[model samples]
Target: MQQNEFAIWQEFDPHAKAWQTLNNDRSRNIARKLGIGDPSTARECLDCHADAIAPEMRGDRFQISDGVGCESCHGGSELWLNSHADSSVSHNDNLKNGMYPTDQPIARARLCLSCHMGTADRMITHRIMGAGHPRLSFELDTFTWLNPHYKIGEAWTKRKGEWNGVRDWAVGQGVAAENLLEVLTNKSAGWNGIFPELVLFDCHACHQSMSDRTWGPRQGTGLGPGVVRLNDSNILMFRHVLAPIDKAAAARILEQTRGLHRATTQSRDATFAAARRLHATIDGLLPTVAAFDYGPDSLDTILSSIEADADRGEYRDYAAAEQVAMAAQSVVVAFENDGKVDSEKAAQLRSRLDTLYATIKNEDSWSRQKFRAALAALRAAAP
Candidate 1:
């Protein structure tokens, strides 16, 4: 059963093929333009594309072809493999023997974000994106559901506590938000040459067509045209999570987030200061967010917040819209799972979700007006 699950995961895994694909024509073309030759063996590319480990750590049986193998996520099995087989051993004992504590939502999220959100060990820079790498985006609960290899039955829950998607989503947001600030403040990881790593900013800010002249001003920032904004998608989503439990904290976070955006148009020092303040605010909320149980009322609050943001033209940008879609899906699914939505209502909500998802399906053809309309319709149809 374990072997079958592993095969299934690997079959659909992007990480498994990262190395081979990096050597393909498309990646090579981009790499050539960026003066990166043969990314298959390039240290910069290999660090993420292939299994990155020290020479001594990789045994004779170890192969880069395994990609992100069990050891990659679960840690080296040598210490726990024998003891783990004995039924007499406790789960905690296995963990103590070097198994990763992925059963914990926050720990799992941190591990996933190390590569997905980038870290001091593996930083995804502007140059990598310039070489045609896709922008990084992660929501732990959503990703886990999409690629579930293990069933969380009673036996599973006995080993690991009850799995909560809402809790995972909330924890993920805080972790991701914290990671963004860490990268921004870190002198070595944040900067490349003189620029402040524009990749950390919204991709759509500078990627949009020159001919599209429509610019709806946001009152929150009061910023004008041609100003790059920080990618606050995670922070924005995190606010929704906080809204149900602590309205005051949510409002404060929203204010700080807007302040951070406004600071971007000013000096570098201003941006850093604003980011630090906002980061501290989010960091402080982690304990409450991790502990709070998301019930029906909580789901409603989050969904309501998402709708409010949409109405305010916050989802006009592709990055923000994408995050909104994920947030809406997460809340709706949680509501359904908790029996907050009946079968009939679930059907209706699912249809509305499909419409919302369709709006952002095609990035090139994304219409803000159409998306807003779809979102408003979804909000109206919500139970």
Candidate 2:
């Protein structure tokens, strides 16, 4: 009741509206059907819906109805609450006192994906979706910026650290790739009885009508029609994310990605084994992604890599193409932020960006030809 009642207070009071997305009829009904409606028994629902922390971690003022309160993303208030407020304390000190480093790329990515994607402890398997839950998808930089609670101004940089939108986006892709791989390798999470979890695969692979004819070859996956390919949108985005910083690792990831996809068609054991190898590869590159400077050169390289994917029909799946759109946004924001693009060029690119968004605006009506044309125009417009 409070989230909606205090909706107007979100501007100055983010707690009023920022995280209260779960107190709805739909969510309640879904939880009720799944026998997790009551707060006492709704651990599964509360994992993402509310600040369902350990009893010991919660303070006196803590209430589950707050729905993803400060402590959910920040940390428990008992230790760092006063420390974070003290100007004398360094950011590192706050971290030492239990504040989550939400400012960092890899840390933020993993934390967000723990619920946005899922971990073994809070797995949103195909069974959950079967119970009327929505399909989950997340873009790190996009999601963060879409409903940003704080601005990355001069003071933020001084307090936290350097802020690179594209770099964070790249690291997010790598982390998301790792999360998916973890699921594949985890028997309890990825497999239900003898069947592999369908949620791990592309939704359009089976959701689309048989007559739609969207199935085409993805060179990286090397799969033919009628195969339920893993939703490798994050893996695909690595082409752009890593190529600019580490080409050899990028190529190795591509090879491993293909192997993982092929393994799915073979056997459960093969899929898990391939996913483990790919997971290790991504895990290795994470620190590199986190530390690398995503400057103008790196941003330009990522944009060109995205254009290449569109040209080669690498975006046959809706998921991969969706990431392309988010990447374009991240790159454009970075380019404009660093004064790489003049106003005139940005104005022209705005329409091209709109076209790209329009093409994928409706997943049911997504067109490969239209998206490619839009990407081409954006590429041509960029300096």
Candidate 3:
């Protein structure tokens, strides 16, 4: 099969030779699937693989391919070359044709997300974009532009390719959301899965400074890293947005999120202890959430569930949760009452949640760090 002209070529740099050798195998196809390109030579590698340059380690020249390119996620590029260019090719086709494989959302997202989102391994700690290559920001919907060669579509069409964008979003949201929930539980280990939960700790609602703060005693006693204040407002944000989906579950999830936030403020020992308690509750709750049949018809069931259980009853301890539940329920009503969910209604719910989240952050109780962390997820989804 003939390669297209867009297929630029560069001589491999000895420094990058190792990754190049690995990339030269089928992994190159996966890069193409991701909409990134494959180029030889250090300069060209930087051209397509700018992510190679550590944001923190700039100014030094290295042979390692900088930006995550063709071989990074897909595996060695060698075996699939002949079939890759064929119009009949597919991600699974390439896998069958012989390339190290992965199909699960968690695994695949972890790979692409490694460089795309910036994690412990591939920290935002680098800069390849300004080094004369496309920037490495992430948005699952538009990211395919990075791998135009594969042509994954809005819907999975065989001729287009075999990919699951929806599934990716679902699992990514679930995992990322859960990770945030964990960090809200405890901030000291915020970087756990490399998803950047600390960013959520920026309580724009309460904190005067984004990076500076001292919530209370350091976890290690002597004076460890400063703590960020968090609050319960976003806990309400969660209840509002999620309650209409399932009130009892939403309330439970909100309290659990708050519990996680509370954990972050305490010592590691306390945090873990809280985590164990929270995790047990979540273990039972999440499976039930997963089992919910949340199609169009289920909307009424959710609304009734919320209506039957008032805020004064089982969920009295959670103010943020109640407010958020109301906000979320309002959005659901607006959505169901009308055929389409216009931007106005969505924005309204988002604004209410944001205000409530901000209000909680300003409170004297929970750390402000906790409030923002919980709200960030709502902010992303709402607007």
Candidate 4:
């Protein structure tokens, strides 16, 4: 019955709209151009936009119309469905039965990124983006908070321990960085025909208008025009996350991150070698990030590091600036919730945050100068 219960889930799901919008004749134009007869029936389109589970696993009760239901992230409900109903059953027992171990921050992040960040099983190529699919960007804590189904409270804490936004954010960065490296290393999924998957590279590198004359040399890359660069937004944010916990490791990661950018201009072999080294470094730090507690002082330090990055012109692209804006808001909200910021200061921070958000709200008109000024104002207003 759960599988056939479409009205309960699909009626409210935002993902269901992806299928609904694409199945229509008007939206299928791009898909048709790409040789896909009908996006609704196309295997490639169904993989990410809908629940494209194998037919054998999907019983008669299971239905794809329920679009990204509980089973999507929680795993199949067969084993634990009945056992989970018993009040005496502990959370660990339910997990042992079949429930996904989503309570673990890193585990949850990996599950979310499997879809958001793409994987070997489901690749989000540049062709898909060209077919009107929006550019994918995800931060775990932000998305979790945005999800309407659950709340983090006493009951949730009892089941999953205390919810830490900073930890989620940190784990998310490491997971995304790791995922990118894995994608880069995978021959089957990383390459499309003869061209490397352009979707993985920075969009702004080639998507900018011809009239834009703002191209300049970046010390981070040491490369000139026409060279596609690896998207480093996640790695850049991860550096700020590591600064308060381990300054030396953070500096080393930053150096390798720049090295990776430079390697992109050289050859595929060099890029993969550089990515492997950086991935190992990030993997080593994930455990510390998982266990560390982010107190008020640490939050302040992290925010300060982000501000420093902005001042140094590290967030020149809209993608990096958008991530920073979201991270800043998350930190400020967390501080406010913990009573670290007084009401007056909270109001001031919100005003500054509004300006920061406005700067990147419109991608076509996003100005690096306006965003930097807004970021400075936000730092000045921080308590």
Task: Estimate, for each residue in 322-359, the C-alpha lDDT of model 1 and write its tens digit.
Answer: 87787778877887888877899999889988998998
lDDT of 2 by residue, 228-325 (tens): 88999999997689978888888899899999888988988898899999998888888988899999888778888888777777998899888899
Cα lDDT of model 4 by residue, 1-383, tens digit: 12333453456657656567666776588688788888877887777666778899896788666556677777888888877656688888889878898778899999888878798778878888887777888888777776345556786687669978888888888888899888987888887877788888888988899898987665555567777877888988999889789999988988898888888777879988998999999999999998988777788889889988876778877778888988888887888978888999998899899999999998777999999999889888776
Candidate 3 local lDDT, 189-254, one digit each (tens): 354464334344433233335464543331111222344433333333333334435566666765
Candidate 2, run of 10 with poorest lDDT:
1-10
Each model's lDDT comes to 0.80, 0.82, 0.43, 0.81
Stretches > 4 Å off in candidate 4: 1-11, 16-18
**Native-to-model Cα distance after best TM-score fit, residue 255 in candidate 4, in Å:** 1.1
Check candidate 4 and list the clashing pairs.
Answer: none
Worst 10 residues of 3 by lDDT: 215-224
- For candidate 4, the TM-score is 0.94
lDDT for model 1: 0.80
TM-score of each: 0.94, 0.93, 0.44, 0.94
Error of 1 at 257 (Å): 1.6
